[model samples]
Target: MMLRVTDQTMTMSAQRSLAASQARLAAAQAAASSGQRIGRPSDDPVGAGESLRVRAQIAAASQHQRNIDDGTAWLTTLDSALGSATGFLRQVRDLAVQGGNGSLNQNGRDALATQIDSLRKDLLGAANTRYLGRNIFAGSSDAPAAFTDGAPPTYSGTPGDTVQRRISPEQTVRVDGDGAAVFGTGADSVFGILDAISADLRNGVDPTGRLQALDAAMNRVVAGRVDAGARLSGLQRAGTENMTERNALEQRRSGIEDLDLGKAVLDLQVQQTNYQAALAITAKVLQPSLTDFLR
Candidate 1:
């Protein structure tokens, strides 16, 4: 069978070829300018889904880092207060030792008692410390302070549970310390210990036994500080891990979402050359049409 060749069919074919060349040129130029591979979901469906997932992971990791920062601050504030409390307790122990000496007369003992009393108040102040206007040792309680003033300071903080912060998918940190555990609950607490020493000195009673009580209170404060240090270490470790993971996710997303500028530029040049060639061919082929001869 012989196929008939027609001028109209040739013209239509040339127009279609030119349109395709122009479309390729436009796409290449867009890729060069935007610097992203996934302009639309249809560009690369699998790559687009992966990019979205990685971006969401990055956002979640960022939030985790923020939680770690906040938790670190809370622990730091609590630790500072505990350090001061430890110092005050040590001073109280020294005073108790001086008061315990038999050579010290009642009048001398009274002066030591006064200083111990002052230090006890300072210790109480440290126990009732707040970070960001919330009691750090009060667990979930919204109380301003953990302890109330009294002969034996009372724990007004309802330490229901340890306060926790989420630093990552698999990790959570305890940000609050147990107040009743560190300082004692009521009149039987460290404040009570100091008050007993004061009363004994005024009543001509020897305060030597009170030295042991001071030692016990100092131990509690020291232990609390140790716990805070451990928590701080964990927070730092989690922060480092989060940063590492976030970097990896960003790199993976860049592979899926960002353009290879070198390749895009080369492609754009090739497409431009092809489009120009197509335009030249279309002009040469259409120049000898019947309409041109009539003109």
Candidate 2:
């Protein structure tokens, strides 16, 4: 009876040891297959919390990258509008130079005047540039056109309307530019000068001062175009910087979040070897049963 009782105790101890070994092997297998130690909070609460924080950071960085791209696209639209506007102003300037020649008879001047009118209409259309259903030059009004049709193209919006674009954490850049500065105001406006010239031409009046006014308007437009170009350059620089930083951050985040395939494969192989050894040991230990002892 004493010998049988001792044997039973030994068997139970061996069974418990084998069960622990099997549990460890299962854990190693799961870790190798999943490639993550903490599947849930129940697996490792502290590690899960860290993973959540890292993931949130990565998401925020990705969103910031998208913001940078959107800002750049908007700036590109603005640049395109400015380029077209520059060309329109150049047409007006050419007309001004042509009209300045006194050798032109009344009929010649009238023809040139008509050409200027066509170009002015084109300029007005250009001023109302829109991208994605939003007016780029309307000073945040979202108006269909920056200027309304009349004797002189009149502004229907306020001045100095601006918008901010966030390029980075704690860093914001201004994207919107005031329309009045570029278009001119009151008597000095391109539309105003063009209107005066058109009226003088209709009255059969010599538009000597009107030609000079066009020259002045041309200068303003050129200067404004240059300013717009500078702003676009700045936008490009800022966008490039933001992209570089964001990409670097993404790389860093990947280092933390993404599995190292080389290291992971090595670890998996090691775990497989360890698990197989444990299995072999367990199989040997588990071979003895009550039936074997009875036999």
Candidate 3:
């Protein structure tokens, strides 16, 4: 049997159609105004999840960039200190050569020794260099100075441990150099070597024999500077990579969440037109009066 159609049934159907059309129009207006494809998870659950993931990646990339910057500063400071120490050592080598001269009398030797001692003090200052109130040469040590004041300066840094910074999820870089490795510990330290040479010169003895040791110390400082330079280069590269990754992540997020303003505006206009048409049609269909009901 066919279902009977009544005015009440027709009115209810028209009302439901208009309400659905109004809801679509409201959604289009919201998308246009907000300029986002996914305003809430309910809008597009998969896209929202992807947007969240991309946002998290962007945050991590930002943090990694910060780490790269900090690590660069630390390595730059260390390289500068090592460079200064290398110069000081070179001067010390020259002074040692002058003291080793046979024609140089005791007074001359004493003068050379005094100059060498001054250079040694300068070298010690370089070894104890600090950046941001922390010792660069000291390996994860909280000490104020890397080497203590004494005849033969002692290394105050942690032996095996080093200060490191994580620049990426898979990569970490050591920012601080090993004090003991760069400048030997106890009597074998660069300061100690200088002390021994100074003593030999004051005693009117040849320090040419210790030239090999001085050369070794100079080499160590140079090597440390080279290592710092390498690390700085790596960090610079990582910083660039992190920036690129952030840009890519942002694009991915935009694709997932951001709406095209022009398209959204067009869609809003279309929905508004459709909803108005639906209202007009509904109004015509539901235009029955009480007289018709009485009939």
Candidate 4:
């Protein structure tokens, strides 16, 4: 059976074919220009889903890297403060020993007492050290100073919680140290020890008790430095790991989301050629009017 062909049918068919060709060309051009294989979910559902997941992972890794940077700064500042505290404690300990010497006269002991008094204030200053307007030793307390002035300096800041920073999906690190634990409050503290030593020197009394206290305080400072040093080292290691993971994620995301310009351009050229050929064919195959049919 022969199927009768009509001008209207031919024209309609040509239009549909042209529209489809144009759609293909548009899609190829979009891929070429946007630099992405997956523009919309409809393009390739599975590919688009994979791209979304990879992009999300990239973003998360980038955020974790930022957290690691911030954590590094916090730990650096805290460690520096602890270092200063260690120096101050050591200096005061030496002065206490000199004051305890039997041959030292009252006036000599008084001079040593003056130096020790100055060292105590310096230690207090170290105790109340602030970084970015926040006390380094004050834990999470945002107080300006960690210690207050007195015979035994008072710790006004709370025993704040340790600040932890996320460096990866599965890892977090302690960025802030406990201040109350390092420099104890009031009479039993480093400051208190210094006070007793100064008072004993002025009164011509031996500084044996003060010397013992000073040794214990110095040990505490040493322990604090050790802990801070360990944390700093861990932060360094975490930072290195984060960088490695970030690079890996970037490569993965690029494989899924990034466009292959060379291939896209070739595809675009082929699509353009096909569309042009369709136009030429449609002009010849579709009749413009019934005049052509009668001829």
Candidate 5:
């Protein structure tokens, strides 16, 4: 029997269809096994673009959240160092009050004067607080102290070049407190007040007059600490907000980009079944060719 032209074309068309279906089945099986929607842009251009967008958003939000966390940590360090400095200043003020009493003999006052001197040195040392190898209170200067060593405490750092670190898109906070603003006043520096108080107590001069000035210096330090503490509180709040926001963004991104495990497993089972079925059908279709069909 002679085959018609239409029958020959039909056989070739069916074979191509089976081959194409087999290829699709194999790709679907591979996709299910790997648990990804798009292995290549040609596989699913629309889905691939969406996944890329979600991934980019996730990366950006994660980095922003990290920045907020890092900034909060740095601010926390500043608050701690300021707390320590405040304690040192208050200690010196307490010494001033105790030494002001005239009832103590020269020996007692002399010894009290010595303690006061040591406390002053401690206060100055405390002013040189550093974090990450950079001065926390020394503004731009990394000097041992914010004050001059000789006689009066001199202001060391400039104001304009103060360091400010970016904590967020719209926010930048000062990383280092201005040393001059923190310590030295216009007329007399913190060191000057401490020195004058120490000298007055040692000479049996009018020590009562120094009490007001010493307390003022202590108050200044405490007030500055409170301000820094407030700023730190703001940063902590910002970090928390950023964490929550970033988590939400990541959740959305995951929904858009991450594979659904349950669906992927089910799809894998279906694709595997289909792939096996296709191979069996293809074997039958390609086996014995037109000779088998006649049989």
Candidate 6:
């Protein structure tokens, strides 16, 4: 039996073909205008998923960079306080040496003792240094100062607790120094050491023997500063690594989601031509009859 070809069948087929061509051309135009291959998840599900993952990584890297900046500020403040404390201790040591001189009379010793007391107060001030209203040496404690004022200053910081900042996914750094460890506590503290030297000087007693204690205190301050310097160096290195990671993540995201403008423009032109050709062919194939023209 011979199969009859209907005009209705041909018209439906042509319509479907033209619709597909128009859809492709619209997609190409969107890609060219938006400059993004994956406008939505439906465009490329796998690439969209990968792009989301890369974007999450970029957000985390940005947060870590902020942490690095805050940590650097805290450490910088702590280091500066330690530096000041070291200088104060050095001056105290020099005064102690002068007070130990055999030729120095009572009046001379009294003057040296007064200077030592003044320096002790300055050192106390350094110990109580704050950054953004937070005590940098207080080890996470919300104390107003690292040490309390008294006959022998006591450590106000919480023991075994410290302030820390996460600079990366796997690494964290201590941003606050330990006041008790660096400045000692009670009678064993640098304040107490200064007090003793001042008392010995006022009593006509040589303070050269206490030089050992003063030297030990200065050493602790130096060590604290060294640790701060090391942490600062590590933060600098982490910042560099973070920048490199951000650049790589951006490139990955571009590969997953972004389109090459030149390629997209070319594709749009090709799709436009194909759609125009399809329309011409469909018009020729689906010619209207006299009955259709009357309707």
Query: Considering lDDT, which of the candidate structures 2 and 6 is the better prediction for this target?
Result: 6
1-295 per-residue lDDT for model 6 (tens digits): 9998888889888889999999999999888888899988998898888899999999999999999999999988988999999999999999999998999999999999999999999999999999999888898788788888887988888888999899889999999998989999989889999999999999999999999999998899899899999999999899899999999999998888889998998999999999999999988878999987886
Instruction: State the lDDT of candidate 2 residue by residue for 1-295, as single tens digits.
Output: 3545565576677677667766765665566667665645777676567667767766776676676676667667776766777787677666666666767777877887888789788888777777677666676786767778776777766787766667667766555545577777666788888777766665666666666667776676667667656766766776677677667766654554455656667766776676677668766756777887787
User: Alpha carbon lDDT of residue 260, candidate 5?
Assistant: 77
TM-score of candidate 6 versus the correct structure, residues matched by position: 0.92
Ranking by TM-score: 6, 4, 1, 3, 5, 2
Give the poorly placed runs of model 3, Cα more than 4 Å off: 1-6, 288-295
lDDT of 1 by residue, 1-295 (tens): 9999777788889999999999999989988899998888999999999899999999999999999999999999989999999899888777777877888898998898889888888888888888888888888887657887766767877656778999988889999888988888766687888898888887778887877776887788799899999999999999999999999999998999889988999999999999999999899987665784785
Per-residue error (Å), model 2, residue 191: 0.7
The TM-scores, one per candidate, come to 0.91, 0.80, 0.90, 0.92, 0.83, 0.92
Q: Which candidate would rank higher by lDDT, 3 or 6?
A: 6
Error of 3 at 62 (Å): 2.2
- The models' CA-based lDDT, in order, is 0.87, 0.69, 0.91, 0.83, 0.70, 0.92
Candidate with best TM-score: 6
Tell me which of candidates 4 and 5 scores higher on lDDT.
4
- What is the lDDT for 277 in model 1? 98
Ranking by lDDT: 6, 3, 1, 4, 5, 2
Candidate 6 regions with alpha-carbon error over 4 angstroms: none
Clashes per prediction?
0, 0, 0, 0, 1, 0
Tell me the lDDT of candidate 1.
0.87
Worst 10 residues of 5 by lDDT: 283-292
Q: For candidate 3, lDDT tens digit of each residue in 167-250?
A: 999999999988899999999988999999999999989999999999998999899899999999999999999899999988
Q: In angstroms, how far off is 166's CA in candidate 5?
A: 2.8
Residue pairs in collision within model 6:
none
